[model samples]
Target: MFFCLLSFYGGNGYAENDLQRDNPLEQYRQLFAEQQKEFEKQRRIIEEQGKEIEILKARINSLAAQSPSSQPPATEANNDQTVIAATSPKKKIEIPSKPVGQAPPQASEKPRPPEIPRLSETVGGVLTRKGNLVIEPALEYAYTDNNRVFLDAFTFLPAIAVGLIDLREIKRHSFIGSLAARYGITDRLEFEFRAPYVYRSDSQRSRAVSIGVGEDEIFNASGNDIGDLEFATRYQLNSGSGGWPIFVGNMVATVPTGTSPFEVDFVQSTPGAVFPTELPTGSGYFSFQPSITALYPSDPGVFFGNLSYSYNAETNENVGKVDPGDAVGLSFGMGFALNARSSFSLGYSHKHVFESEINGQTVNGSELDIGQLLIGYSFRFTPKTNINLSLGIGTTEDAQDIKLNLRLPMTFDFLSQAY
Candidate 1:
């Protein structure tokens, strides 16, 4: 009876173990069904979110189309889209087709006004954009005439006085051609270099009472040489909008690379006649100029002004110790846009020079004042090319009588991808 009981108990335990093994497999199947249900729910949620995004994008595009300035012009927008499509790999969205003979969407009830093209802000003497290079070739012509009188002292008896008068006339003509290159290091900083070639002709006529001369003795001299080399830098201090004016600071240095008048040999062709072998192309000493420029924009026109001070370093040469006078300058101008491709400008400039020192002594009658009236015009040939013309008329005795200038400016870009 004990053995029969043991066998029955063992069979019952085996039956329980088999039932537990089937329950694990059934639990795995149930877990897998629950995971599939969760994944399906997430996928449906994602599809709904994608539809919402598409609807939002369509609404934003519709609103942009209604605003003239909010979106680019039709042609530009098409071109931009074409560029994006060509540069990117993206899946195209398909639209559902109507069953048969579906009607097209209705036109917008309110039509958007046509957008006017924005005017180009480029002007003469303006700084270029960052990472851009500008090359300007210019030619200038100037003419001036001066008259001088010299008095010779004579021995006087009692109250009677006798003196000799010398009258002199001098006429000068100059032509300068320059090539300037400017580069923008940043949005607010720029550097420039300029090299100029100078050609000059001088005519002098003098009459002296001591020397018997008929129709005064006339002498002519001419010289052609390179002028001073200049390096300049400019920084935009602040960019102003509305009623404020833009401010720019500038620094310029000039090297004494040209022929100096003091270095030229003096020739005496006849008695009481003295003349220089050649005309000077530049100042003999180094100079530095610092200036501040301001510009105020008012739609189709711009008003500009500049204030500057220049300092010249003294030099000791074969002639003697010489120091060129320091100068202060002021200028004000207005530029007007005539059309999309042309502009005009009118301006005035004034300069005052202090007395010069020679051999540690102040030179008498060395002070000078000069003033000029300027007019300029610019025409754009292409997006990157311009032609500028200018005229300057002297308004003071020490200034040149007239000056004419022509300039051609071209722009280029390098390493554009780095910007």
Candidate 2:
């Protein structure tokens, strides 16, 4: 009886061990199903978040389209998109659409150099945009004084002459008001037209050479008329990339429309003294000038230079066929941007004129040298309007003593409808 009872207990214990093993396998199957469901829920959440991101991106783009200026910079937008993507699920890297080994297209709206003050009328500070027009009204004033001594007889010693001596002093004043219009055909090419009105006055004092006169006689003359008309075209030669200088080519032409010196009447003031009854308003001949300007932008300042050549056409005058002298010019300067709306320029200008010809004969002692120091300032009053002022001081006898120029430029866009 005892042996049978022990065998029964051992069988019961083995049965309990088998049941425990089966329960564990069933539990494992249930745990696996729960884990799979959790994974599916997470995947659905990721898809929903991605769709929300797409909707947000569309809304942002719509707002940007309505107000273009309100849009952020390209770099900033790209960085924001990168941050958004990093916070989400990982994605496969995409290949670029462009072909491999090909260089990227250069950007047309690259950073441009700062604008400088205008040093010359032919060379403007900045170019007008395409399909735009700029109208500039300007005023100028100049003053000069000249003194001359004429000795009719040969000099016997260092400061002594046996013949008559004539002493004269001349003071001149000039004023000009002009209107100019500039039109941009393309981003790199422009045309300009300018018309000027001039007024002049002169005073001359002379001592009689024939008599031993201690008193000087004074003569006065004045004139006012329309001055020469001018036309100009400018073209940009380069894009100024890769640390290269910007180059511009300019062509200017002048039409003679004012009163010429030869057309003016003269009166005899005293013995061996003659003066114009009315001062001249313009040169007698037409002129054409070609010039090149170079600009290099270094930090905090800009270095600029210009070279030019002028040719005067021959004309028939009352005396003879008069040919004005040709001239060569050189100028260099540095400009600083004082602020966003203001700038300053300092420069030097020089010109050398060849001898003139009368009736196909070269006139003796007719060559001249002109030099001046220039200072310019520019201020922008609005987005489309600005004022520029410049002062010139003569450094040579042939140049004017002092010159002041003021210009106000206003711009209008003609292609805004296309946008």
Candidate 3:
């Protein structure tokens, strides 16, 4: 039994010794061979992708060469995918065959400044373009009412009169039609001539001091004739820039061509009351006026103003030598463009007249103050024609109660082809 047991133990020890002698190098070699196979598979896949990239680059080069214009050959680095992407063709732009409301490229080389709508002839908002002519026909209507008090007896005490008192009221209506022509001598200067026809009608009411009639007496008179002619010249002083206003200088001359008030005969309608047989058509005095106008443009609006002085020449009449009063005038306004074709303006005008002289003697109560508020509107019918309407409301007793004027201006460009 002991020999059997020893043999069993010795057999087990020999098996353990054989297991310890086995080498790990053979297992490591087998694992390395499997990893090498995987490396070769990955290398083959990378080579296939490179060939595909070359094929795409060749296609891109062929397409670029087929274009209408040829470009210089790219460098080696430019053939890369990133560089090629940067050089891709841009989308073509399509232009319209006939462009609307756009000036030709050659004509737009020096673009003109924006033009503001014209308000009135006196204000001189914008000058006529060079080599152009403007013809304007205008119609105007005015109405006036006057009240007067006369004392036949001398005053005995302050605030007390011991004489017959007379009261009178007069209403008048006037109409005028005028044709004017303006020519542009240059871009900055213009000349204008105007001729007008005038018609007037008047009604008078009087209460006599000694007459027995209780109702007011009425008198009516009317006259129609050619009126004074006018000539004007305007020159621009400066170009508006750097937040500066544009200035224009103007001079106007008038010629008396109509009937004078002294030429008309007056007849006494009642005691202490007299009325003219016919009304006068004009002032019957030559006059000259020099003025300066200024305009400033802001966003969406324009401001304008003018100052003037009028000198009336003395004239000889049957009554005596008469010197009409000199007048100082001023006006200011603002205009807003409602749209591309329409605009509106609001303004105020004032004039102060000095005392008149008759035979070197100052006429009592001959000084006058005239004030009016003006509202104007303009509409453009075409590029060469427009209509302007203005209304005036009197703010002083000397001024007309209401006045309305309408004008149509048409322009002709004789030298447009030359330009």
Clashing pairs in 2: none
Model 3 lDDT per residue over 161-247, tens place: 765677889899999999999988888888999999999999888897554668898989999999988999998887776778888
Instruction: Write candidate 2's Cα lDDT for 1-419 as tens digits.
Output: 88899999998999988887868987788789999999999999889888867865664555445434455566755665565666554862222223335466786674433477776865448776789999999999999998977767778799777776888898999999999999989888889999999999998888966578878989999999999999999888888988899988999999999989889998876766788888889897899999999889886788989999999999998899999999999999989888888889999999999999999999877899999999999999999999999999999999999999999999999989569
Candidates ranked, most accurate by TM-score first: 2, 3, 1
Candidate 2 C-alpha error for residue 24, in Å: 74
Candidate 1 yields a Cα-based lDDT of: 0.76
lDDT of 1 by residue, 280-300 (tens): 998889999998877777768
Q: Candidate 3: list runs displaced more than 4 Å.
A: 1-120, 162-164, 210-212, 417-419
Model 2 stretches astray by more than 4 angstroms:
1-107, 110-114, 151-164
Task: Report, for all candidates in order, the number of backbone clashes.
Answer: 0, 0, 0
Better of 1 and 3 by TM-score: 3
Rank list by lDDT: 2, 3, 1
TM-score for candidate 1, please give it: 0.69
Better of 2 and 3 by lDDT: 2
* Per-model CA lDDT versus the true structure: 0.76, 0.84, 0.81
